[model samples]
Target: MESNKSGFEPKNIWIARRKKQLRSAIIDLLNQYHEVPKEWIDEYNNHTIMSGSIIDTIIIIKESSTNCYEVQFGNGKSGSIVYSELDYEFQLFEATSEVEQVILCRNKVGLTKDKSFVQTMIDWLTSIGFIVDVDNGLRQTT
Candidate 1:
């Protein structure tokens, strides 16, 4: 017989006051910059690639709202709706990949694919005065 064992230790490297200062600084930085990274916009502009529009695919975390908003997954590049073997919508993998690359291009971009990421994003957005409804993911996704 064997018993499960766990080893974990919490470490505090910074003083509470110093941590507060650093946290304030980060929040200030985030609040000041409220635009999608220009690198993505510029790159998208330079490339004439198509199949879907950014409006339909990009998960724009707009100001005052915290929803990873995106349109319904329908209509393939070939103008057909696809479904998985289990009767779920089969997202256009290639197109969705492109969208993810451009919108979630940055390390901070959280998405539905990762719940932790989405919750982290919600917290950050909330701190920045955005109304995040994480529970409404289905509504937002659709």
Candidate 2:
């Protein structure tokens, strides 16, 4: 689905600025890690999120110095990649709310891929005082 970063008031501005900030920060990181391989971007990232009918987008994990998160995938195996290391593949999804980005990673995790990730995301967002809906990809609520 197309992303919805727009909203009333200064929110749309804030989201736009945040997205720029993150992209800049990640670019700086990439400059520092110049030798990072294409494999990490292609092989590791382009993998399908799940094996079967419930499959969704091809997924990648990303982190930044400001954000480090992990997700469970395949028989409890978990992996994380620095957000800056995401390459061009993740730019679209990662540009959304950071919380949503992490939830996407979480959804891609684990063989079962159930609602627990959604539950966890709802808890996290609510804890931070952001009324968000996980099923809606953490879109802020009115």
lDDT of each: 0.32, 0.32
Per-residue CA lDDT of model 2 for 19-119, tens digit only, reads 44543443343435332333432322223222222222122233233333333232223333323333411111232334444323322222124544333
Q: Which 10-residue span in candidate 1 carries the lowest summed lDDT?
A: 73-82
Clashes of 1: 0
Report the CA-based lDDT of candidate 2 relative to the real structure.
0.32
Tens digits of per-residue lDDT for model 1, 29-119: 4345333343433333223133133322123222222322332221222111122334322222223454432222222332345454334
TM-score of 2: 0.21
Q: What does candidate 1 score on TM?
A: 0.20
| Segments of candidate 1 deviating more than 4 angstroms | 1-14, 34-124, 127-142
The candidate 2 region of ten consecutive residues with least summed lDDT is 133-142
